[model samples]
Target: MAKDHTDPIKDLRHNTAQPFEAARAMPPSVYMSDSFLNEELTHIFSKDWFCVGRADSLAEPGDYTTCELAGQPIIVIRDRDGALRAMSNVCLHRMSTLLHGRGKTRAIVCPYHAWTYNLDGSLRGAPGMTRNTGFCKDAYHLPEIRCEEWLGWVFICLNEDTPPVAEQLADVEDLVAGYDMTNYTETFFEEHVWDTNWKVLAENFMESYHLPVCHAGTIGGLSKLEDMVCPPGLPAFNYHTILKDDQLRIAMAHPSNDRLKGDERRTTFLLAIYPSLMITLTPGYFWYLSLHPKGPGQVHIRFGGGMSDDYAGDEDAQSNFEALKTLLDDVNVEDRGCTEKVYRGLCSDHAVPGHLSHLERPNYDFAQYLMARLEEGRAD
Candidate 1:
């Protein structure tokens, strides 16, 4: 039996504190503990810039998508003024959630009651409330959440104190400037619940070491494991690029694209944005995973992928994206199995964290990021 300890994850700091050559995986307790999950919810998720989806997806007025952060339910929508906005999804009157999923709505109506709210989240109608002198519709505007767009990706921050997304991710923008990532068109976006700690899936994405084995049936054959580069990570994010073979045409820069020369034209950047946004960006396409914890045992994931505009005029662009999406789906299936198995193994009393490989440098940095957030939580 595992002995109860005051801080099972305190060793996580120690493990991550070591040099990269000697770094170790975080203690398994970090993934299995309810207390740590609560701390992470209060500290990290509550204050981070969460990518809702691509801004272009909700381009027209009345278009909206609903999501939750930490424990707060939010609705990201285009209002009457054609502005992207984020507001509480919960009705002000009876507190029932206002929206269920992505769709167009001129007004948000609480299913539990007839209370209706305009696209701007201002209360429009309250049936049978005329008798209630205390009720003021004008005073019942749904509280707004902070929303921003960075490179066409929509992000929302619950903490008003956090810096703007673009300002924070400016360097990331600079690094991938050659790709014109904003021009990419989203092809698919879906949500799923995976039976694993969120961090397990995140770390899986952070390293390429597992690709040859875990993803062998899908992308494993394509990964240039020897050439992948994972230098020390930047504070806001971490990335490793794999050199694409000449045979993979779409992964390379287009003939029209002169911005990326030499190896930059053939490298695929796998970026891990902190607090759970994992992205794989190539010259011709991109995919991402935005994660949220259902609890200590499960993770809620938003999976999306798209094609670069370089292929916009090509007759085969749709077919290429379809194939890419299928391959990505297979990759996701492999990842799910690996991460879930890792989580299940973590429950064993004999399970112990092992040393990290050189390729897992991002995983080490990720651990550092987590501890940093936890300390910030403590300070507050």
Candidate 2:
């Protein structure tokens, strides 16, 4: 066997603890090591409450969506009784994945040996199992997973002992209350795989430092670094506020509402709920990215956004929606190019951690969250 290499966690531990003023980016190997990815899957994603999608998507009974959490296949269904339920999508009989995508389905049927389950994951039928005297359908429901709904979004936790989503994000809820997220209607949603480390994407969304450079031709001209203010990170999240230019399309399209006052009407909040969820809220609209690490070098992103009720029902909604989507598509193209290049740079032999700018406080907070979780895993 080849000699073992030093673990990247050693570097992560040292770099993460440094004071913010002297802090460096996480070690390059933290973005490229399989071992480090495994640790994150176990200590962070598996235990953290992460949003997958808005609950409104499952409005009708029988509507369901399938997703993967930290590599384990899961299905979220609106049961016949109008309750939302989440459970393993794996067929209990032969271990085949039961659902391929989202749609209306009376029941989940395995494409393999015809094993069937009710919307609530109860085994409804398992053809040929009748011959086995020891088989009991009632005892074999698809393993249930813990799930919660907050501000119209559905969150799931692989580890049942983790705190509830509401409890973890109470402060965030209060901060964005004026936007009325609970009533926001999702107008668009998509999934994409990015060729970059998951943390790279998360950090990219958390800061405005790159906006002036990477998005210069698009929304960059609207941003001013001196006007961006990053508040300290909390146990569950980090957020930054920035004043929006009234000339931007989004600002111009937003309807005035009594829910916000003074500068609140002109400010946008960008938040990263620890581990995965990224949310951007404005008086006019909101959008979010729920990130899932596919591995050290890839991320599965669930991107969705919506308009506040005031604008969602406006006569100009469709035209505005089309315009916003086009703008976002262009921004994503720019982000994908930049992040993929960063991943490539990190893989180079000369790659080394560099001191972070004050503008990168959110990235520093993310590093702290990573270190805390890794340490918790070690203690366990």
Candidate 1 per-residue C-alpha lDDT over 194-261 given as tens digits, one digit per residue, 9 for 90 to 100:
99999999999999999989988988889777898998888889999999886757777878888899
RMSD of 1: 1.3
State the C-alpha lDDT per candidate.
0.89, 0.86
Tens-place lDDT per residue, model 2, 1-380, is 10148477887898887899899888887889888888998899889987878888889988988889888999988999999999999998779999877789998999999898899889898887778999989998888889899999999889978988999999999998887888877888899999999999999999999998999878898879999998779989999989987775555325557878778888899999989899888777788999998878899999988777777657887787788778888999999998999998988878887889899999999999998998998898
Off by over 4 Å in 2: 1-4, 252-256
TM-score of 2: 0.96
- Ten contiguous residues with the weakest lDDT in model 1: 1-10
Model 1 TM-score?
Answer: 0.97
Best by TM-score: 1
> What local lDDT does model 2 show for residue 128?
79
- Tell me the lDDT of candidate 1: 0.89
After superposition, the stretches of candidate 1 with alpha carbons farther than 4 Å from their true spots are: 1-3
